[model samples]
Target: MFDDATPVIRRRSPKSQRRRDGLIQFAHDFTSQNGEDGILRHIFEAVLPPNENGIRHCVDVGAWDGRHLSNTFSLLVGPKHESITIAHDQHNDGSWIGHHDSRSIWRGVLIEADPGKFRELQSLHEPLGNTCLNVAVSSNAVSESSLASILQKSTVQQTLPLDFDFLCIDVDGADYWLLHDVLTNTSYRPKVICIEFNPTMPNDLVYIPPCNDNLRHGASLAALVELAEMHNYLLVETTIYNAFFLPKHLYEQCFQDLVPDTSIEALHETTMVTSLYQLYDGTLKLWGCKKLLWHRLPIEEERFQMLPPSQRNFPFAPNITSTTTEISDPVVDISAYCQSQVTEPLHSRRECSSQLLEQLKSHGFALVHGTGISAQLCRDALRMTHLFLQEADESVRRSCMSIRDRARRGYSPINTENFASLIGEQGPNDLVRKFRIGSESSTESSLLQPNIWPAPSEHWDEETCDEFRSVVEAYYDAICIAANSIVQCICDGLLQEDEGLAASLDFLSSSNSQQSSNQRNGIPTTGLAHKTSILTLLGYQTGSRHTKKHHKKKRAVHPLVAAHTDVGVITVLLYDSGDCAVLQRQVSNSESDKGKFKDVVLPYPVPDDPIFVVNIADCLSALSHDTLPSTIHRVVPAEGSIPRNCLALFVGFDPDQELKLKEGKTVSYETWRKDRIAESQKVLRNRMSVSKS
Candidate 1:
């Protein structure tokens, strides 16, 4: 994922704020039509509204720290105008705003109503309008204790024709309700309203759970539209949850005024955009997706040029882009599904060992061969001259892996007599040949070049290479420890029935061996050890494009290898990085063994190859699921170098270890795979029981 947090470019500076050309253009576009709001939301998706009109009369409810009021006044009034902005919230005093004015003629009122938050919204900003309201706007009248309402019967001249010009609402949970009440009750309403219609929207996704969680409760867009119309006000456009609205009169005139003011060609009208927003029928809200107002809408260059950095949301964040919800059912909790799989009769998740389950979770395991195997281990035993010679010898080894027959390279077996005849020449079920990850080979020609890894470094002394390998060996050994721990856990209760040999074999041996003398004691007659001994080499086969899906990285094989949920657990044996690990399923004879186990050879990027840069870079650049805080290592394959000498070791597991994770602790949709597997098993068993009944 892209981790870079820096903006592509810094925002425009302060001297540019004086330009009204851009603001006029944006204002025109924003109010162009009923849907012009969409155009405005798009441009201001990451920007603040222009405050050039001054804060002469403003109202902000739930304006913690007075940040909104502070920003509006700073950009527009800037102490030059008789602006009176009120910051009213149930939260904090004005300290969080981080700005103060002394010997200045800035006028405003600060009101804190919630008794619990009286001390916080408790700042004194101006010498006028020291009144604070005790009542909270609710479905019904309600008051908090800390705020003692002191109502003096003021005449109509003093309070009735109250001039509340611009209004901003930020109270959560009750925003729509409160805004509805204020618009309906007040005789003289504000000209512009900034209400948090969808809080935790398009912004603040990290702090709040995905907005879809809200849909589950029904406090959604349908509610917003309902509240809007009751007050003769229409819900304007929105950027995230900050919904801007205006009375029918103002809404019409505002856009009507801005339409003819357009001078900049880049500034676009919002009519078409609003139509698109309404077309989804609440699907966007249900999925917790946000409409990006920036790409479609435009702001006057000067207005966008003046805002501070904090006001803009960085749209380029890695996970900030569009997300597709893969959850199949909204009502089904993940944990319950997983638990069902575990407890289901016959098809219980416990049917597969936990080790197998884990292998399924990681897609596949890293096939590690015999331990203590690394390049350095071989170098320490050899003389320095021989070390250099061995490296050179590996360079010439590429030609040894070419396939003369096209069918073999494709993993497509040739027919009857030809398959038999070729089996004798090959001597094994399948051969491990060096193949490139991005190898371009056709049936017309032979590919003889070797794709060895870590092209030999002529600059390093053999002893140095040995030392590096020794360290790598230690790391590899640690991974082996982790693998063995998993295998041992799986094999723990497994070796109980008929020596606990895979429960599949017990029926075969006892009865058949019991009647024959070849049954030594309780052991089976077919030579229990020989019958159970199966070798499967899992290497990359010659595969066309059944590529990995939903993967951030494009792995050579199918997307499921890296991104798809695994169907079953598997035991991996490594022949080599480029070497093929062939699995023989049911071979009747030596020659059949080669044919029984299909070829699956994984290709690797080698040093000195052109693809080496692209593939190795991708692997190193990719990130891991868990943030281990442990070391991550990568070696860049250089050009004009010897092929890399690499070996990988893999552990064992059952192929069908499927279990869903419970919802409680699981983070995201990753818990879905286990969820789906669990659901299927549970449903399968329930169906089976009903049939029996």
Candidate 2:
């Protein structure tokens, strides 16, 4: 029934209609996007009535030519008078004061650092009752060009109110620092602040690049929000690149209805979707701008990555795609992977394949069996550990006592360690004697202390002590080799899975190589040396003095080693025990099985083939974004069981290697390790005090 030439009318919704009406009433564009100029005009009209005789002051840093992309230019020129040209002589000093004009009530200070731009700014603002400064504003209070110093040089300094009406900062670089200084050091607290922010950054990312005069790296909106809150300001609105903040008291009085939601997410949601993201394979995806706007460098570099290359894989991607769609690959069942047996020969590096990587990713452990580390070598190490513990006299034990402040590289007597306290559980002290060893020669000898070996005594001869030291050193070297091979295999597997990860890893490796070379050349590097990794020989003596003390307390079970996660990258454990002594906590969905500890069974060694159990430790788990879990395990012997011995090589990154955790905190490996150790010790001390009470 409709005519062929009839035009269809589209009805606007109530919300859209209101927006349209608003635009018609207040959409004046004076070099500002998103109607910022009109908004500011309305705000000023409401707060500072033009009818009053009071003179309102404004400050504009980085005011280019005083008009182009200027926030205060419209306010200076006023809404009524469109054309008014007047020539005025410049003052002898670098400052120019304009004649009073009846058309405008705002008196502003326009500052531009560039010499050429300052000339244009003076020519434009000198006739409009405004002050123009040619000096750059410094955030440092001590600097000669500081805002306070510069303001003192101007004629308007006497008239400028402590609580100024408006302040606009668009210096691009050091905007945050400048504002912070203005609020903290000086008495001036502007009623409204219009600051520039990097629109390309994510809403949650709180990044403030180092302040440099030559660099124009802008601060993030989130950082500005935090700074505003610190100074009793509430974020009211945001354009694409600028955020508007109002004093909390003023906002509460008049602007509550205007901005119902003052949160950054509500105001700038569209601009907050970051261009950078990560794929399931640890591949970074640059969705929008690939280059840094100010630095003119590619953002795909390793330094800009949210997480380290080793941690970018699935389940570890801090910023992933927004969609809920799964990857094309089949989903891996964690339970099946936990139960799967991944075994490789220690001698053959090629056998450490994807299967082992998968098992490590799921179950956090794998087994290496072969002639690379002969059965005889393991037996000899275990025998020496037992002999050293049993034969060492009190004097020898005291001489080798561990220096708690340094790298614990000596002897720790029985009943000294209570690892279960780390997980908030109180258990009997471990009935174990430990001897730790590190590289004999180290560049930083103070940090990595020298190993202390038992000298010739009544229990052992000089020749026997020499043989024991030789066996321990040989075992340490062999385990280090196996650990290096396993790490290389893991890196190779990750590279194979995702080629993007290889580039980042390569970049990191090249950086580390350069740092290592610098250290070798005595360049005074800050990173820790690679020789700081430790090897611990654990001897669980049955019916010992510590065990007797524990038995007298009538505990249900004898815990040789309490439940705790290892502190390094990976632990290569070689134990001489027929029974299943190590128990690992198997996390399950079933309510009844939850938190239960399951036995970790080791395969019987055949002839010359010795087996090494490799488990993921805390550092690797953190670096890998928990794609590999740090397995929580403990050593507890069965009733009527004989003594057991274990030689565990705890491999770690160079002490100086800095790691960024998932929560966006960066800390050195050594510091991280020391903190964990300190926490464990504190808990142990607390538990010990409680037990004594």
Predicted model with the maximum lDDT: 2
Off by over 4 Å in 2: 1-351, 391-396, 403-407, 441-447, 498-530, 544-555, 578-593, 604-607, 663-665, 677-693
Per-residue CA lDDT of model 1 for 265-343, tens digit only, reads 2121212122112111111111122233434443322221221111122333343212231211111111211223345
Residue 161 lDDT in candidate 1: 26
Local distance difference test scores for all models: 0.30, 0.65
Instruction: Supply the TM-score for candidate 1.
Output: 0.28
Least well predicted 10-residue stretch by lDDT in candidate 1? 609-618
lDDT of 2 at 148: 68
Query: Considering every candidate listed, which one attains the maximal TM-score?
Result: 2
Candidate 2 per-residue lDDT over residues 266-384, each given as its tens digit: 67754334355556655565555567665687664443444322122355434422323222122212211111224434333333446667867756777655325655567678767
Q: Which ten residues in a row have the lowest lDDT in candidate 2?
A: 88-97
